[model samples]
Target: MSKVKKRIRPTKEQAQELNRRLDAVVEAGHTSNLYCDCDVCQALAEQAKLMGYRTDVTIKRPSDKWDRRKREYERRRQNDAVKMASLAGQGLTSAEIGGKMHRSKSYINKLAKEFEITLATKKRGRKLCH
Candidate 1:
């Protein structure tokens, strides 16, 4: 037989206190663009737990399309193209590197071209020597 789980609920007074604190936190966050995952918000979450409240919260800053595009590009820029090129220099084909790195062969080719690394194309299942 499968075991059933029990739920723990807060008492009335604890619930009231938790609600008051949560409202204040939400109100402050709305005006300040405060994200829930930040350190201050996380501390507020811990405080809520200590006060007998369990809550899940999420908050985000507003941004336009340009801001979103810039953030995406910055995130993509963190990839290790230099390391990819170094791996290619060690006689690994784009497909092999893609397999090892969990990336597509086309992405490997793009990185190779962007970094000026020459990849040797050979027959399937055959590796080229540098």
Candidate 2:
């Protein structure tokens, strides 16, 4: 014969005690939501919710404007473009410029095109100069 096991549930007193422990932590002040998965912890959360305390955590957000941040990033990109142009103008190869700029050769080429810059040689001799 197979026997079935029954689950044990917390008594009302146990539930209230769990609630008091959780409420005390919240009352002492926690800024983030406490994660509860255990039976006692979950029961405590339910109890505090019943006692009128918000168990939900509030998330803080950054105050910076997205538009302003985007503009700043664009300005940084433009500055990178200027640096790349100057480096290329000084006989630096596209690969060298890319290495210095921490970018791929393809990305450097794209940036050069976008900024109306060229990767042509700096001088008329030796058939080469980047």
Candidate 3:
């Protein structure tokens, strides 16, 4: 013989307790939505819907203008890296390049390393005769 399992339902008091907890969560979602419409609040609203409650919360996404500005900034940075690599290939010291580009010598050296460019190093003091 096959055994069948019956489903157990919550009692009246347990149901009331569950409803109170759901209401508390929904209230918290409403408060969070008032401050910021972030992912956490959106998840809470979805949870309320799954628990048989309706919510009017909406999630806000980043604007297209912000994404465009970020992409432009990255493009300019890559162009500058190419320019720095060309300048390094021309046998110019980092200090000289920094002077021409109005950037710090350390900044130029960092970019050169990042772009795998070899820079010219200046020799200091007098050379000894063999």
Candidate 4:
């Protein structure tokens, strides 16, 4: 038989103190700092966790450096796709395009498929003697 654990409820004074601290933290614009390792924050987190609540709260803020880097990467990828499309339009085979772009034939094929650019498929080998 498993023994059941009794949940200890907080007293009225403790509940009021917790509410006051929470309000103060919120009014001080420290909600984002709730995940801090400070004594008060840790105590509050522990209490909330014991109450069957989530203690880890995250507030997401936009990062300008990350956003700028992402945009730059996207721009470079778009430009590469355009270049690949133009190269395909010039009747270059996948292997030739891969060599020129310093990429693999599979990469060229994937890019062609992604950009909806049709690539030429031709047989390349030594000519057979009759």
Candidate 5:
């Protein structure tokens, strides 16, 4: 049998701060322009990356392309689903949520499924380390 690498769960304080950063970005429909050099911020950056989360620290708020900007306006529902999907449940479908949000059905469905895997309660399947 192979082993699944254990993911490091963030500290409560860390989660709070990361939540703050995310809320700030979403509320403004823009990324932050400054990187918070606080120790908690750095730890989050490292841990999220280590866990295969692709994230960018806001050293400067980068301007978004047109589509990106449009999506930002539409992000509220997706963001809500993101939180919901992260919870342990039967989970919702993209098309169901999409109709409510007026988003592309395919995209939302894909996200719902992906989030299910990533936030899965089950352990990851292991592969042979050749």
Candidate 6:
């Protein structure tokens, strides 16, 4: 003969108490059609567990892929700008700098403008004979 285990259930008073706790946390998000797992919800979950009440936790979130990609793109652009400025300061022409970085001279010029970097060899006056 196989033995079946009986499940423990909360008494009526315990049920009411657990319901009150859950209500306090869930009602805050009722207007927005969302339920957050904030501190209040966490406390409610803990209280329900202590009272032997079965609980289900659910969380919903929007996709962050676009936000993450935008952040990464910005970071890379800043790093590239810094590198372009460093190369320009080292007396490398835009074409040489672009070739070294596997980019076009125009793109290097664009980065230079964006970073407000002055090219080292772009003097406007008459050429010196040294």
Candidate with the greatest TM-score versus the true structure? 3
List candidate 6 stretches off by more than 4 Å. 1-62, 120-130
- Each candidate's lDDT (Cα)? 0.69, 0.70, 0.71, 0.75, 0.57, 0.75
Ordering by lDDT: 6, 4, 3, 2, 1, 5
In model 3, which residue pairs have backbone atoms overlapping below 3 Å? Answer: none
Candidate 4 lDDT, 6-101, residue by residue in tens: 656877876886797687667667687534555556666666665645444332346589779999988976887888888988999898888888
Q: 1-130, model 5: which lDDT tens digit per residue?
A: 8996666776787677667766655565544534455554555566556444645543344466866878985696568666556442444445545555576766665666755533233336997899
Runs in model 3 deviating more than 4 A are 1-58, 125-130
lDDT of 3 by residue, 1-130 (tens): 8985443554677557556655765776665444455555656555554444544545456568977999998797688788888888798999998888888999888887877888899989999998
TM-score ranking, high to low: 3, 4, 6, 2, 1, 5
lDDT-wise, the better of 5 and 6 is: 6
Clashes of each: 0, 0, 0, 0, 1, 0
Candidate 1, residue 8: CA error in Å? 54
**Alpha-carbon shift of residue 31 in model 5 (angstroms):** 8.4
Looking at candidate 1, the ten consecutive residues that score lowest on lDDT are 52-61
Error of 4 at 82 (Å): 1.7
TM-score of 4: 0.48
Local accuracy of candidate 1 as per-residue lDDT tens digits, 42-93: 6566666565444444444565886899988756644657667777778888
Clashing pairs in 6: none
Worst 10 residues of 3 by lDDT: 48-57
